[model samples]
Target: MSEKATRNFIDAYEETRAALPGVGGWLARRRESALDSFRETGLPHRRLEDWKYTDLRQTLEKAAFAPAPAHEGAVVLPDRRSASAFAAIDRHVLIFVNGRYRVDLSQAARLPKGVELHALADVVHEQWAKDLVERRFDDTRQAENIVDLNTALMSDGACLRIRKGVKLDKPLHLLFFSADPGASHTRNLILLENEAEATILETHVGEVASFADVVTDVAIGDGARLNHVKLQDEASDAVHLATLRARLSADAKLSSFTLTLGCGVSRSQSFVLFSGEGAEANIDGAYALRNKQHADQFCVMDHAVPACTSHTLFKGVLDGESEGVFQGKVIVRPHAQKSDGRQMTHALLLSRDAAMNAKPELEIYADDVQCAHGSTVGELSKEAIFYLRSRGIPEAEARRLLVLAFLDEALDLTPHDLARDALKLLVSEWFGEAVL
Candidate 1:
């Protein structure tokens, strides 16, 4: 079954390669190479260490989704709060419905000077864009072959480039809505030059059982800074796989956080590399799940240069028969002295049937480096719940408060104040509907 799905994907690529963007150029050759890599390793399964918890091959075989159609005409955003979670925030917006950019739904008219924003197709011919797309970090390429599938079939995405010494006055929001029952592959590129600064917000919401495969590659120049926040609340029957790859230069900084609230099966992977001295990165996230939902978070931080710092924290709650997994690793190279990295994952089980799997590792070759990793999985303290109940608070209310407290520690890591509060409210609402 997995091989058939792989064959179908390869066939789709063959049929659409000529029509895809940047045909007859460097991108065309890149896509063909990506296809070759993907065909070699169909999908990541439990046999691979990085994919031990999430069997993507089996999951894709079960869904068996075809490529999504290019949706035309007007789109009615779903009335659910998840669809408009960031509507109140004033910012430049770009909308993608069913994987195609919707100009009518977007408002990116007056971008600041030195900020160049274009659709992926428009910038594929640019040298900088090609450099970003072609750059490779680790030799364990086959472990993340799903990214190759995205490269071969990516339809559309946003490209943001900030020149040196310029700062985006407002945040840029990318909202993706999956209205149909098919697969959509998207790739976003962000490049920040020296001393440039920007904040980006990403929201994903869908209405049907769809496959949302997205990859966001970011490059931060020396002394540049980027703050990114992502919110994922897709349909319960949807399959979501998102990968974020970021490279930081000397004195550069990156702060990224993700909040997951929905989807039946979802995996979020983040890879951060410190290529220059004195760089810093903070990666954090929180998630809440119920029913039979499954969510996995994978993060790897590489300290290849000296005097770099990286910190990661992920917290989640599982209810009903749900499951949660967190796999994180931090590596410090031999000559990368003064490299400081810390990683921790914590999960709260709200039901006896719920399960949590956590693996945190540290690989250090530098004697002067400070690296530590720890994971904790436990249920709500019954004593604390009883104490709250004894105070006359209702049982549900007590549980809600306790759960919120458990997740707040992680939410506090979000860099944006407004987005942080918005995510907290969404988590509260999710608990209200979850009935405990």
Candidate 2:
């Protein structure tokens, strides 16, 4: 909104670029060029089709951009000692702090044979960077705003490649955090080779005033199955913008679920490309917001090949002055004959001040494909509340029970155990109770 904020954005990016290791080198030079593009493009406006329902100018007012500096001393991760898909798994885990990797306090388990995980900074100068971008990049048929911004300034993230025919028994956890009171950007890539199968769990959390910017690109090979779970819980004063792009091959399956129960302002975009025929992609997500907080979940599912299938379910609950936005696009290319896509976006509003914006699109160039989308916003059914009251339950408890039931599907879909509990408590706290 103000000229100062725009300048602050540029200044913040410059500051981070200067502080990055190996300055003036090849990697830095490339990043500098990206920074220039980022400045020129800046943040997207409402004119963009995907961002029409959600506004970015609000973030301009909420943000005070600066690259978080190196956090000194030791910082402990929150303990969630519970049985989880993460608990049963034993793959290498990478952790980051203020956009920088923290080798300690991470779970770098012994991975199954023939798997390579790189902490981006350690390998950026090598040929792998070029190989990665060229072979696995996801412009998603179009460069969305978040992807462009993330590409321009991302400092550090993880890159993993699984050998052909290898099956990783444990899921890899890529944990990222930003404790500094500034903007933090992270970029990550995962490549599953032909006949390879792997699962990845990524967590994004911040306990300090900051902004989280992230981009994830995944290449799923033929016959590969990639299960991805992303968790978002940040300080209440934080801003988060993220994009996830996945390319699926013939007979490959990709299941992705993201949870959102934190941040003052947050938005997540998923761009799924069903490149190979018979590929299946599942998108399931939930968001709980209260106390004037806002969250947006947007998606684009493209069936570029014949016989691809996709399914999406997004649910949200808004309380107090909170608001939620959902925009979904399902595109079927002319060649993508017999494609099957189903999508639904819904939100429950608890207060009169609460609001939800839902947009579902179907762009079909083929006549044989089947695509359907729907959206809804409403309050709890009085009959259900009355039935609970008739059963002698208190009004408050009745409300809480119904809210919990509304969110069960999404939470149950959460692949990680601790993350599911963490999100449940976040929802509980939004109502007037302690998480304990």
| Highest lDDT model number | 1
lDDT of 2 by residue, 172-210 (tens): 777777667887778787888888988788777777788
lDDT of 1 by residue, 297-393 (tens): 9989999999999999999999999999999889988899999999999999999999999999998889998889999999888899999999999
What does the lDDT read for residue 360 in candidate 2? 89
RMSD after CA superposition, every candidate: 1.1, 3.2
All candidates' TM-scores? Answer: 0.98, 0.90
Error at 350, model 2, angstroms: 0.7
What is the total number of backbone clashes in candidate 2?
0
Q: Which stretches of candidate 2 lie over 4 Å from their true place?
A: 1-6, 18-29, 78-92, 125-128, 131-145, 415-436
